[model samples]
Target: MAAPFLYSAWVAASMVLVPFAALTETRKLRRAGVSVARAHEKLGHATEPRPSAGPLVWFHAASVGESLSVLALIGRMGQALPQAHFLITSGTATSARLVASRLPPRTVHQFAPFDAPGPLNRFLNHWRPDAAIFVESEIWPQMLRRTHARGAKMALLNARLSARSIAGWQKRPKLARYLFEVFDLILTQNDQMAEAMVAMHAPPDRVARGINLKSMSDPLPVDEDALFEARAALSHRPVWIASSTHEGEEQTVLAAHHRLLKTHPDLHLILAPRHPERGDAVMRLIDTAGLSATRRTRGEHPGAQVYLADTMGELGTWYALGDIVFLGGSLRPIGGHNPFEVAQSGAIALSGPHVTNFDETYDAMVEAGAARIVKDSQDLAATVDSLLNDTDARDTARAAARSFTESQTDQLDTIAERLIKALELAP
Candidate 1:
């Protein structure tokens, strides 16, 4: 039987509940340090000047990772369609900060408006984007409906659908069809995702198999002075990064580091928690491990056994310094953060077994000899030990990673070309 609370009912309820929802979300944003003056942007009022008299394409991403994944795509699309201006919108303060710092010329970043009818209408009317591209799985019902009504061509780029989400949408078949069919094109990260979208009744012709855009992301920028200082402080010690670690995963990383230290006493760890705000708690974990540490957010250099990289936007710097990268989130049930980002950094990437989130990407890398998987802390330490001692094997893994990542660049060009055709066909 279909779910009792169908999409129509949810839409009706949303039409009435939007005000309370907006207020609650606005409060959270304020607490997260979003500027009060510019908060109106989230309410569908523009604080920045809109680009005029061109084929303006609007790209929407949920947060920092998604926002950054599209940077290279936007740059490619900008070059391919020189007449087009780009508007990038994300829903977080951190994403806004990153976008502002990294966005290309002639591109604008705005906090995405809430999916309420009022704000979305206000946003659409003011900007009147010719085409809209949404990153990953952000299929906001009201936003999708409003954008479709406004005659903007739409595409779901690097689309992913988990088994749970597919099951939920299957409960509302018509609603699923309505949402999926609205997009002029749907580009998926893998054949598995493409097949899932087809099962949800997304048009087969419109669904194109493609790679994860995160694989094609521009290398994270590094602060040269910071890298220099980090090198000087470490003085050529062996290093590895626990990149994008979550709550329970930090303890695992700490345990692995503790074990690795006993064998390779000069080994260093850069623990970058997934959420920088968790820095304090992570520091406490490090202390419990009886390890000396430095917190990067406090402006300390990495001269200790563990460096807690509690700051944001510096993954590239650490990646450049690390000999191996063990991606976090996989250690816990949070799936996994992007390993391609690690591979793109030219580091030998390793992860735990629970990486269902990027299953295809990870499987491909492992098959290509670009990544390795560890089942537990002992395995992690053992693998890291082997990699560190075997210089030739380590170089082979890093080279394989770079080669696989570079080979996928042409996929971006294919996506950009298809997107341009979609834009031309827009009403």
Candidate 2:
């Protein structure tokens, strides 16, 4: 019912790219994982498959945030189904690296097959998963249809549908109807998203939206020795961190840093880009801002300048190093990255006003006064400087951050239970 309409709108929904195969294939080959570029790469070569006939659960997380949101469930699933093989797929290169960084034992990571029919069919033929789970709002017409046809129990966990996305889905209602019908259970991020999915043709009675996974603590792992070394070198310098920044937002951090240094002479700032490939460009932007900063890829200390926390999977260390933190992509129009990650690490969380991507989480944080909102660059600098100088204020912010993040971290658990029932598995 929902298949062909979605299949046709793959283009209209801006879902499929006509030139992606040609553009991405060569880039995937040319780029190396350790390099500054290729940060968005999600999967590796699916050229060969090792056959497995056991009960295999397939978890699909669209990118870095969506991918991380499923971690708790993945860990719990492993405990519940220790005998079952687990296969997880994330859609971006950075996500692949992050998943590879800390996935629990027994889980294997793969790049999601492109939405094209041929690759998806090939993947289905080989993996033969017993269950398929979607972390968020990833709808592939062919993938859903064929996976159901393969006798796999399909569920959407921690799903969300915003007003903006709803409008677009309505534009292609025929396609959306097909996509919506394919799921046996749709576990949403919030009540609003669940209501929206209902309007979009998801099974109303089966729809459950309650747990918000982004509010979970950051699984950012830090090396104790490395932490000691960085801290020893940093030495009482008031610190702040900017994690997962987008374009045009770098200058804001730099501008804030310049103002912050005036009052707190030893104020140190760290920049962790959303894309690792853009490390050099961010370094250049920092340099152009007339601030002396060192790239972490080099062994240089922050030293009265900024430190580019340009390395991947090291947000744990950076978050630990900073007292005040800003989760970027919010200050600009880019749907802000996860604020929950920093909050769990005990950093004071702040953002710019444009956090439409995680509005519910952001609003909750604001209502709790766990996060500070900076509407523009000037407010950004002022807010950061104030947080840095005032210990009580910083502590208040970090407390708010932890409270909001801790409160919303259990969606994965709820989804896990529903998934078991949907699969008709024994309790």
Candidate 3:
């Protein structure tokens, strides 16, 4: 009964939202630098024909991080179910590029359609996926309902429900229950999130505590030639990296670097902005600080005190050049970026207190002594100084991080088997 009302309400809301969403997409395409010509893909228009053979499993992620988190699982599942072909969809242009560059064989990438009746139906008709899997907190009512109507087995993987969102949903319990009930299974990131799912009326049996999948993801890919050049140019300088930094955080990072420079004059800082499109703005910021900086986009070596690695898809290369890494996005209330990538790069991870976005993973890593937290520039500089000065502590943290990462491997196997079994049982 609630399902009918919820569906009707969603239909009405989507009808009203379609035009606004289209305008928003145009703005995002402009800012994010995706092609305007390919913008039709977001309206449920297919750029490539659906594969003619094999059962298709559709995975939808909202952006780069979510897409990367599930990538290994998809590969493992594809290997186990060789007859299955994977269709991965994301809404962001950046994510689409990463998917195209790194996607495995028997898999394809597409931009997801907007959540309106026309677009959702067109996407469903063309792809006809046997199973639909959505990552994290992306809940689209039209997409969920339309996919369910088409008889696709739906699963929510590595799901997270923030406290604020939970509070909002509690006020609309029937609507929440109706929407969550659409998922055949709900694999949550932690016990807190699992409890939230049950509280919101997702069947307790259907919802299970799952490990954070980012801990098991492969390291971001690197370009070998660039890596070699960067390493050779450094010539064993005392180095640290501030990776995936947002707007306000870079100022703090520069201040921290300035302090560190007073003691070690040749200390090199690799500053990687979260969005490479902010490269020009970052250059101006460095100039304002009177720091000598070189942009990686220009294919320059690190001859200055600071290296502005403002390029895409080369985090692995930068990670290899430094041992002390400050994971960004945490310092500026942007939640936090993943730290496991730094761990995989064999660096000691340092982060700020605002890691609620990756709460479970960060907490586990901290408890295991694999990561350290910083409150401000002074704290960050001190932590980096301590780690770089003590080889034993640094190596121990590095080893603990890799061990923590290794301990989570079996969870993916369990998850893959369960998903494959569920897909097999689906009509």
Q: Kindly list the per-residue Cα lDDT of model 2 for residues 1-427, writing each as its tens digit.
A: 5246437666344335524763664476346443323222222235335435457888988888888777777787767766776778876667777787778757787777666555666678778888899877787666787788899888887787667888888777667767777788887877778888888777787788656666653467887877887788888877788888988889988888887778877888888897777988998998899998877788766655788877778888888888678888887677787777777787777898888767777787778877778887688888887776677977787787777656654655565666777875533
lDDT value, residue 332 of candidate 2: 69
Q: In terms of TM-score, how similar is model 2 to the real structure? A: 0.87
Off by over 4 Å in 2: 1-23, 33-54, 161-165, 409-411
Instruction: Estimate every model's Cα lDDT from 0 to 1.
Output: 0.87, 0.74, 0.86
Better of 1 and 3 by lDDT: 1
Of models 1 and 2, which has the larger TM-score?
Answer: 1
Clash counts per candidate, in order, are 0, 10, 0
Write down the TM-score of every candidate. Answer: 0.95, 0.87, 0.94
Q: Residue 53, candidate 2: how far off, in angstroms?
A: 7.0
Best-fitting candidate, measured by lDDT?
1
Look at candidate 1 and tell me the lDDT of residue 239.
95
Q: How displaced is residue 208 in candidate 1, in Å? A: 2.2
Tell me how candidate 2 scores on lDDT.
Answer: 0.74
What RMSD does each model have against the real structure?
A: 2.6, 4.0, 2.0
Q: Model 3 lDDT vs. the true structure?
A: 0.86
